[model samples]
Target: MNQPETNPDAPLPRPSTFPDGLRVQVQGFDDQQAADGLGEQLTALFVQMGRYFDIQRLDGVTIAIDYEEALRSLDRGCATRELAPSRGRTVGVAMTPSVLRDGVLKSHVFVDAAVFFGMLKEDRYERAMQLLAHECAHVEVNAHYDRCFPDTLLRTKYMNAQQGARSEVILASWDEYAACALSAKRGENPEADYRETFLNDLADARERGNECIKAYRLHSQVGQIVREIREIYGGLMKHAAYYLGNAAGFGKSWRDDPAVAEALTEHWFLPFFERLETALAALYAELGVWPNHDGFEVIGDIGEDLMCEGGMYFYDSPDHPGEVGVQLPLTPDTVPY
Candidate 1:
């Protein structure tokens, strides 16, 4: 018997449960008496978003809190950075998993309830809820992809091909585009001005990275690594700001832009690296270490298939394997410190 090859980007075999509405659950927050109230609000907000996007649904989300022992005490399944309590603006982490809980396969989410409430009290109410909505969008996308292509093997972005990504990458970018644009449709703030916050984060990361690059100017390896990180992430940040700022029409706001619409629908990565690579090569040719190699190939040793934190997603780069932290995954699985 011959089964047809499955298209990696093919739609899910089954329909989404959104028509029935999604569900949410909270765990591990009893210690912080205030956590329950926040959890309840977050859950309600997520449910409302489900009604809005209505494309895919999560089985259920398991949001947990751990604020007493460590100010930041949560980590998602495959975190690229170690989380510490000292990191200010602390909010608990979240993740989506398809694993057995008590010997039965359960897929859900976990979050830090206390940290979330703290942010809420600080009047960051809009941003806090938006983050939750973004994470849910991620789970919804991943959940559907997992079921349809349960055995699909994806490569880490470490090689050179350009412009193609895994279903996972598409999932990440789509949700990011949607999450940012969703503001016009479902948020308390009509335009959801918080989208600019990501640009601020990007500027901070790049500025800090530039400082490190200058400090290690003589260190060839260090310089090259820093350069790569900036170029790859810079493109995503640029696109995120574009998608978020463009103010797409309500209901799948990402669709408002023809480019974003087609890129996501066709399952391709925008921000072609060639231009960025060319600029980088010219900028660093004086270093005399980059030209010796064809293109970056360190992903095998360092890249992880998935890295999640609320707004940022570091995963396989579609065009080239061995690259992590390039595409945007909206569903950020957090780690408890």
Candidate 2:
């Protein structure tokens, strides 16, 4: 493996290898038998997901086992450094007691190693799969965004404007949700069963006015705020269902009623996408950049446009009231050289 060229006078360049073409390298293991076993398992899982990334399992991709090296490599090269570095460095999975107890899945993307050895040691195959899927989804999403979004907007607008939030996280969550949902629908293993059970319980809890269950599961929040939001949304949804069912004579099963479904589908999903668009637009505005329709055609683009328009143009005005946009502070401080 080639080591990153370090220059104290300049920022480091991002790693250029594509995830699909990269190979996995393992280190710190005592024997070949153990490494091979883990490699085969990972290959099988990757194949199952229909991801055709080249995964060469070798020993000694890097001298250090930690992820910081890869992160440093990314920070030097990429303008938007967060998701790409972490997603790009994952190579192999290892078992570590600390990770297991903390429920953290660490990736060394530059070296192409991801550690799931901890989960496997605990016999948590299903959870392991979920984590793998999540990380892989990050790579996929980042690739898609790179291909779809313009390079100019990505660097000047998207990278500079959006902070703390990651497209990888959004994509990963959606992937996990879909995978878990499919597994549950198919009556799969323990992990799938748990996900399905959780969704069902959330549904039940929402019906019974159980605030905790409704909020945490639906909006991905913990504690009172989640509960409050869930309660409000659930109540609104329920009331909407009641009104539609009564008007349509669809009986008490409005949860599955077509009318209610139509309303939520038309109202909720579209608005959600619109809000995302507004947020992205606002971010662009902060960077003094504007996105053309070509780059903003898809969901990611929509998000960018929304942020720009809402944050930069419509914020604090009743004429464009309720327009969602990015909330970046004006005149951001210069990043240290």
Candidate 3:
């Protein structure tokens, strides 16, 4: 295994180890009491997670809770760093990109306190723990995955922004499914909620697409070189991927429900949803098996399948030379003012 690069200039946080060998590093808290309180709770929560999963693998891992620092670090790594925070959000992150601290390759679990504490303020403790468990499961799965297969997809450099964005969505879909499946054994099963969320997103995307079409027909106006329809459709695709993956992770019985089946079919995303769910289950089942496989490659293939089967195709934009345009699964009719 290649050793993680050392950054000597990085500031070190004071990490505390609990009785179970779980180490947590808390930062960006003004009140020491609050910091200690959160640390103790996190340690306890990790211990609880150990009951179902082999969390012992995370012994040397450092769980970092820093809102501001996490935001800065994640933004630095993102392509849309110049864009406002409302464009995207990061609540937690995990795994094999270990940091070298004091000559030791230490894996990490990062949770943004801004999000976690906000959930707690709303008395959403179960949801917060579910998020934490999902991150921790990412650490566990990533470690095991590294030992098995070489992740060729994410590690490779993409040629363009669109390619990079597509890869990001695929990778995120696979990661969320694996982590959510593993964590849901001990956490909450949110399949019903996820199903509703996806349907709602589909409705909103279609509405936005309608407005974009109306604007283009009347004034020959669009959001940018890329049409607003494509942007909203792309976002809708990602939302479907994430929610369907999460729903499948907990349980797939929802798929058989009359309402969900009808809604998915009507929205024209059922094919993609089915393909993704099938691929996710296959990849997850192959984990820890004898022969190693590149699960990321499988996901990439699934993405191709979805694009072909779900009516998502790309063409050169007629209005903007050298620009790629997407054809969505559902066509939006122009709406009147």
Candidate 4:
């Protein structure tokens, strides 16, 4: 008997849990009073979100206030590199196991101590709560997908090929949209935050594209290395979609904005993004009211449209023999560093 070949880009296994039933864990606060206060805040937040979202699968879930420590705890059973926190608007994250168990993700949430406490120091309690709420919404979203699409491994299949990767990106963008939409509906103003973040991500995506071109041209290790390089850019583009998702969820338009136009100059992403936004707007219109098969098809249609319009995907490189070749919307000459 032989073992199956594993997908290198597949998500690692989930973190181990203790027998203790503590749902909120706070660390690094010197004063016990401060730690206790933070614990109460987190517990209350979870309770509030759980009630509103009707989330009932939080039995094994844990909320860690210290991100580094939380990542260490989450990385314990994994052999791969440690998990990293997102460095964007909200430095918090929610994660689930690589595979669902009993149609539940049992997701956990982690909040960066520095960001959370920094906002507290500035008396930005509302913003800090908003960040936590956004992450909580992510946990709900994960659970919803896991339960609704129990047999699917879409996120885990991201690195299977270009279509899988693109699907992964679109799914991630949808997750952000759903999360932000939930938070916005709960009285947090994610729309205002997205108004600025979207342009920043556009500029970042532009720079990433330029760097990818430069690296692709200069590197001798174009086979495996180029594939890795493309994935790096793809990851950044995935984050850029987060902001784009924000716009769609909030019904905000950036097409007429001068800053967005300037950022997209000499860039080929505008049309693709417009198409994605249209797909997302459709999804947004049906949020929280998924109709079984129709809901799944609605999500699937976005990927179909994305692949159809872009004319870019990962394909086996016939020219390079064993290597993977990618076709992107932008050419090497699209932007020069």
Candidate closest to the true structure, highest lDDT: 4
In order, what is each prediction's RMSD in angstroms?
A: 15.5, 16.5, 9.7, 11.2
Q: Candidate 4 at 232: error in angstroms?
A: 6.3
Give the whole-model CA lDDT for all candidates, comma-separated: 0.40, 0.33, 0.54, 0.55
What TM-score does each of the candidates earn?
0.45, 0.35, 0.64, 0.69
Q: Candidate 3 lDDT, tens digit per residue, 19-92?
A: 36554656677887877776766676666555555444453433345444454453222133321122332223
User: How high is the lDDT of residue 237 in model 3?
Assistant: 53
User: Against the true structure, candidate 4 has what lDDT?
Assistant: 0.55
146-252: candidate 1 lDDT, tens digit per residue:
44434321323324212222222333333344444433333344343334443344334434434444444455453244344433344344345334533542333
1-337 per-residue lDDT for model 2 (tens digits) = 1112437796423432233533344444677687666555554444444332211211112322454544344322234434323222122332111011122122233333444555556666555555544344334333333334434223433332122122322332232332222222111133323323323432333233333333334554333432243333333322232232222221223246353344446442335333433443343232213244332333333333322322221133345554333332232221111
Best candidate according to TM-score:
4
Error of 1 at 145 (Å): 5.1
In candidate 2, stretches whose alpha carbon ends up further than 4 angstroms from where it belongs are 1-21, 27-33, 40-76, 79-115, 152-154, 158-337
Candidate 3, clashing residue pairs?
none
Worst 10 residues of 1 by lDDT: 298-307
Q: What's model 4's TM-score?
A: 0.69
Report the number of clashing residue pairs per model: 28, 42, 0, 0
